[model samples]
Target: MNAHEIVAAVSSRRASAVEIVRATLDRIAAAKALNAVVTVDSERSLSDAATIDRRLQLGESIPLAGVPVVIKDNIWVDGWRVTQGSRLFADFVAPCDAIAVERLKKAGAVVVGMGATSEFACKGVTTSLLFGSARHPLDPDLTPGGSSGGPATAVAADLVPLAIGTDAGGSSRRPPAHVGIVGFKPSYGAIPYGPGFAEPFFGISVIAPIARNVADAALAFEAMAGPDARDSDSALVESSDVDSSDLRVAFSPKLGLDTPVDPAISERLEVVVEHLAKTGLRSVRRDPVWPPGATEEALMPLQHGGLAELYGAAFQKDPEQFDPDVARQIERGLSLRGVDVIAALGASSAITTAFAEFFREFDLLLAPTVPCVAWPLAQLGPKVIGGKEVSPRVHAAFTPFVNHARLPAITIPCGCDGNGLPFGIQIIARRGRDRLLLRAATRIEDEIRALPH
Candidate 1:
């Protein structure tokens, strides 16, 4: 069931919150082989659910009443181990709830467990030094995609209808694409990062929702979005009504670049694009390219730099304890000079301006969420896609730039590949146009249909 149904069911007393949570807990247990949930705080979660039942008995209003949610381990929840899937913090306990967790609690969502993530939520896949690889629910041998892989897999596998994850680059959106779910990264600062010990990736990482459907994502987004004094960047922009009929959408198969795209993915995306054109959109074929030398991989230094600043000493002293991939990134960050950092920032600014210019001609931008379907669990990404040797981060080409621009973006599963793996289609809108992106996604989802749960 989606969150709306859960709210209605619990609200109408058709099922108690405890009953719902118990069922969800059972589901999580049954799906334990997926290793999606690294920690299940059943005692606390049940207590919270029972409290909701009491509140419901009193006829109190709760918007997300009794909705079970899995929070990515990177997100703090008071008294829960808030490790970012790192060995250094494997036993660390959060002193207090991160603002996003507080908001979720206030909205009556029960967090049943902590989902696994890449070490420090840094990698694009879910294998971590602290917690081993999180398997895809559809295929245990394959990855769901990462940093947010645990949360995405939890939702995809029906362990929970909703989960909260973070997207530094494409962590939030990428996993959902591979797992056949909806991952939303609202405009940066739309969901405040507050009351947490540190801001990962220097605020490029935003706490976001991973849900089975768009409506649930929208509901969770609305519940958590808005102003919080703790985060000055957080705004109270009310969601505006958007009509898909009047919107201009640009659909690019490879974003106009000669980027490697698996033939199967291209074929599936074409069918979705055709369906989108019939949905009353003023659709055009246009590729929005980044300014020369601007690439999503450029954000790697920023990510590693932030990690190094926060955990550099630990990394240096205990390199063996860290995921080799994460350790390498931290070392790279430590090796960077102030000049290189400033140069990357300047390039990011230019990339943002280029996207702004592109958006002037289009209300919405569309592209494949990733170039290919989920690759093998043992590999980072496909070594070769569409006959081209690609970097490990090559699949991220379509995503991180949106984060660089602080724009709102969403990925909805469009279809599956011949091997039964899922692929997603991403939609991006101008900064602060999160609602418009959601509206457009809903219209497109209605036409193309989300992958079967």
Candidate 2:
């Protein structure tokens, strides 16, 4: 069941919270091969469900009353282990709740356990040196994508109806695309990260939602959105109702000419554009020029630089203990001087300005969430796409820049490749236009679902 149905059932006493929690636990245990859930506290989870049941019997309203939700291991929950899928901090237990976790609890959601993430959420694929790796639920040999791989795997496997994760780049968006679920990365700070980060990615990262459908994703997003005093980045922004019928969309198969995309994925995008044209879009046309230096190559300094700032010292002490890719990124980050970061920030401003101008003529921008389908589970990303050598950040090509621009973006399942792995189409809007982006996503989501699987 989806979160809404679970809530209704629990509230009406058709399904007690304890019973639902027990069933969910059973599912998680049975799906061991997926290795999606890294840590679980059954006793506490059951006790929390019972508390919700008692409150419900006494006549209380709980929006997510009996729903079982999994949290990405990186997100702190009071008294739970938050390893961030890293061996370095494996023994550390959170002393307090992240603002996102607190909001989920207040909405009556039960935290089942921590899902897997890449070490410190530093990579696109979910493999790590600590918690191991998360496999795609549908195909055990393939990956779920990361650093939110475990959350996407759990939801895809029906281990939970909803999940909470963090998206610095496509940590949330890309994995759901691989796992065939909904991943929504709300605008920067739309969901706060207060008391959780001694130093965050400033304007880049945000807590995100992963679910089975657009509406459930939206429901989870609304529940966690809004400002928190502890979060200096938080601010109130009213969500306006948006209708796709009134909006023109710019569609890009490859956001840049040099970007590599699989031919099959490109064909799927063609099918999507054809469907959107039939739908009531004001107009569907190819995207015009985006700002130069705004591509994936431009954002690496900030992403890697921020990682170095957060974990470089620790990595230097024990390079062997860290994930090789993460350690390499930190080394690269350490090499960049302050002037390099300043130059990247200037380019970020340029990219943001480019999008601002683009949106004046279009309400949404659509592109492939990833260039290819889920590759082998052991690899970080495809070494090559369309016969060209891909950069380590290439898999994150269409995604990380969105975070740099501080915009809201979502990836919805569109179609699957020949191997039955899912493909995702992304919809993006100007910063603070999250509601509008979601509205269009739900509309396109229907067309995507109706397409031949």
Candidate 3:
């Protein structure tokens, strides 16, 4: 059942919370081949569900009563072992619940387990020494994308109705697109960040919700959003309802980046855009004019430097303990000069300003969530796209800038490629316009669903 259905059934006593959670646990056990879950505390989850049942008997309203949810391994779930897909943290147990988990529990969602992530939630593909790799539910040989792959896989495979993941550079958004699920990244600070692991992305990362549909994602978002004294970046941003008739949408196939999109993906998105235009929203083919140094390459210093700053000492002592990809990032970070970090921050600021200016003329922007569909799990990313060899980061081309600008964005499955692999279209809005983005995404999702396959 979806979160709403589970909530209604449990609240009415038609199905007890214990029954729901037990069945969810069974599903997780049966789907272990996906390698999507890192830890499952069946005992704690059942206990929590029983508590929800007791609360309901006392006449309390719970927004997510009896809904089983998985949190990304990078986020804390008090007492749960969160390895962050790295051996370095393999033995680390969380001492307290992250703000998101605390809020989820308060809303009556049962924490079933922790989802897998790329080591330190840094890479785009989910694989590590601690937990082998997370496979795509649709095709086990392919990946679901990462580092939110575990959450995306769990949701898409129907193991849970909802999940929470972190998005620094498409970590949450792209994976859901690959797995054909809804991933919503709120504006920076929409959800209070942590009492957990130190963030490598620092100011850019936000806790995101992953679910089968936009409504479930939004429901989770509602429960987790709002300010907290612990997270100075967090604030209460009232969602502004969007009027469909007055909305201005822009469709940028490549997000105006000199990125190569798979011909199949490009063709499919064009068709989706055509359908959206028929829905009465004014959408034009316009791309944001990005500043010269706003590309993902220019922003690497922040990630590398952050990793070096946080884990460099540990890495220096034993680099083998870190993921090879992450280790290289740390090594590069260690070599970066202060001016290099400063320049990257400046570039990020320029990207933010560019988007702010772009939004002045457009209420929403649509782009392909990823350039290609799920690729072989053995590789980090597709070696080529649109008949051209590209960098491993090419799959992430359309997404990082949204995080860089700290804007609200979401990815919904739009169509399948020739191989029947799903791809998604992303809808982005100005910071603090999360409500508008979700509402528009729902409309577009419905329109896509109605189209003949």
RMSD of each: 1.7, 1.6, 1.0
TM agreement with the true structure for every prediction: 0.97, 0.96, 0.98
Ranking by TM-score: 3, 1, 2
Per-residue lDDT tens digits for candidate 2, residues 1-453, read 999999989999999999999999999999988889999999999999999998888888878898899999888899998888888888989999998888888788999989999888878888888878899988898888889999999999999999988898789999999888999999887888856644335477888999999998988888888998888888665556444456778887886446888887889988887877886653456664677666666667887798799888988888898899988888989999989888888878887777777778887888889988887888888888877887656777888777877889999998887878887998888888888888888989998777776
TM-score of 2: 0.96
Give the CA lDDT, 0 to 100, for residue 152 in model 2.
93
Cα lDDT tens digits for candidate 3, 201-256: 85999999999999899899999999999999998765555455678889998999
Candidate 2, poorest ten consecutive residues by summed lDDT: 194-203
Candidate 3 stretches greater than 4 Å from native: 240-244
List residue ranges in candidate 1 displaced over 4 A. 242-244, 450-453
lDDT accuracy of residue 354 in candidate 2: 72
